[model samples]
Target: MKKIGIYISGLGQSVHQESIEKYAMRIKNELSYNDTGIQYDIKSEKIFYTQDRESTVVSIFKSKNDSEQELVYKLYDFQYHEILTTKFKTKNLLVKNLILFGLIIKKLPQIFLRIFASGGFDRPYLTFYAFTLLLLISLAIIFLIPVSIETASQLNFSVTIPEDIRSILENVKSYINHFLPISCIFAKIKEWLVPVTTFILLVIPESKTLITSLATEFACVDKYIGNGEQSQLILGNLDLLIEYIAENEPDSKIHYHCYSFGTIIAMDLLFPIGNIPSTNVRNRSALLITIGTPHEFINAYYPRFYNNRSPIMEASLTWFNVYSVADALATNFRKDMNRGPAEFGIKDVLLLPENINYEITSDKKMNIFNFFSMNSIRMHKCYWDTSPNGQSCIRLLFQKMKQQDFI
Candidate 1:
């Protein structure tokens, strides 16, 4: 049987193709004990389509023994939304998107809930989107069809209208999307809106879904997670697994290997709207291995969002959270709270000091910001790489995957 290994990247720089390769290398070598070169063929980039701005890269892996069997590794990074926001700050595209994003985020749960209730968001749903887009656009223009004809007839072309008057009318017509030009501001907004909305949905957090399920978790409002679709793409793609579980298929198997903010996104995906209502959905994923998870930050600082959010979803599913004392990104509080796995349905928790005793050197930036400079960031970033201590987080996770029969 083949396996699906999905990686959800944490917050920060986007997970480049190399990062995916290295992470897969850890899984391949640590589990299969093979160092076959792993590479990526980017499935999507810039996510500039529909304004998704996320970058998705996938790696195909075949089992060493069974050529017919393999694992497909996917990295869904919603970093592009943030990238767009940060890179084009003058564009103010990010904040400009809040309304569009908010509306989409609000409606998504109803869409998803309807899907699961009816079976799943499969082929029909996709087809619906296409037809719906066309139908909606057509409806918007329905009233204009006759009006356009009327305007055309009223236009006194035989009267030789002044050029400036014609130009103003042309611009007005363009504003109404009559005959759009590339340079028009309305044209730009129209052009960018879909893409921005696409990007926002691609990385929109499940917190909206969470609030949908447990309305009181918010006490007042919903907190949608992620500034980008790295999470949304992952979640949308993850719908496949969720569908499998909803159907209660016998062969469905999936797992999440998430890092940093990626872990938070994974949390929203797994427990969107709080605890899963169905065992099929809860047990669909074999396990969740979180690296440098910041669950503690959410749980403590943002307790409202964390109130009903759980690291573990079911008694049967294995949830392994990998954190290190030195990694600035990982947290210890969530692990401490989930000390009793059975209580929370979590199988196990790990606090790795992968680089604990490793020596740190500070060359020191000669600048004033040196006040904030430290080597811990170095340790956090390099946890994937082998250190003198001979323990890497990736390697540790590979071992766990095997032990848990996730491989």
Candidate 2:
């Protein structure tokens, strides 16, 4: 039977033809190992359709020994990174900031829940760490102010001052004394207000790179929240692509491999049976694999978007969700009815053994600080890494795929 894999990338990671070709080659090599004993070769081609949108298909052909090459797998890379360029105009800065603050206030509960939900504290404590560092720096500056002023005053000078200069100095001293209390009060107020002011500044479009990245993430999430334009566009493309494949290859078994935010897109496309292709399609076997997904994050913050109704599962489609607690953004796609949508049809699998200590470096010992530092970020991308830790996860994933005859 012919197998087809559709790969959907997440935020900031757009796959080009060269990248997809490399990815297909990696999969081909993995399948050709002793685990499968199937030698495979790939042929990649570009598919162009409506709206000038394009997709790349890497066709994998397999053969044993000197046998004739037979088509076995087709990997299609679908990218929607153009959605990031969607502009969110803010003509009135004050109004925009006020609206953002209001939304944040309304979602404070959900935000806190996300911070303390599960996994490591890296993502949860990132803002707290930044705030703490800023507070320490401010305190250091405040501490040096009086000391520097006193040191300058203590500088003994034997030179006699002129009468006019002395009078001017006295007048300046009097003015300083008169306004010292008010200046001190203003300084204290500014110290405390710096964090809030910084937050407002970050809301501006021309803020720090971190804030811009955050804005991009939120913008993408907003598009997928409701039936937004990006949502409709991606879902439409998926539907059309699947239908086309089903028509052209009746015996093909299609699979979806979505990562990070792409999982949300795939869920939006395939969660409901009505959203899939019509019954006329001959190809019925369809599987879904979601890796490093932030499903819980979206469900926690935007409950209304995903929890409006129960998912109508497609009989021919099966979903397998892979995640690790080490990944700050990834989590077990929870089935809590109150907090998230009822995922009755999906199977959640833990990717790594949390108990086993995975050494990142020789010198850096694993502690609370190091554990929650940059390791969490690296864990998010461990799904495809060839390191020992990632190899174990990949082996487990391949085992799961073998059970479903997906390789």
Best by TM-score: 2
Q: Candidate 2's residue-wise lDDT over 1-407, tens digit each?
A: 77788888776422212256666666666666744666678898888644577788898887756968877678888777664444544323333333333444555555565567633322434322322332332343344444334434435566565667556655655565586763456467556555544543443333333233333555456556743656666677777777667777777777777778877777766553234433522245367777777765565556455543323434456666676655556655443212232233222221221111222233333465543233444455556643322243444555567777887
| Residues 78-194 of candidate 1: C-alpha lDDT, one tens digit per residue | 332242133223433223233333434444444444434422212223222322332332232333333443365358778887788667666666566655343445344445455
TM-score of each: 0.46, 0.63
lDDT over C-alpha atoms for residue 316 of model 1: 49
Error of 2 at 197 (Å): 16
Question: Which stretch of 10 consecutive residues in model 2 shows the poorest summed lDDT?
Answer: 349-358
Candidate 1 minimal-lDDT segment of 10 residues: 213-222
- Give candidate 2 misplaced runs (Cα > 4 Å): 13-18, 35-38, 63-67, 88-106, 113-211, 273-285, 334-374, 386-393
Model 1 residue runs over 4 Å out of place are 14-19, 31-250, 274-280, 310-312, 334-371, 386-391
Clashing pairs in 2: none
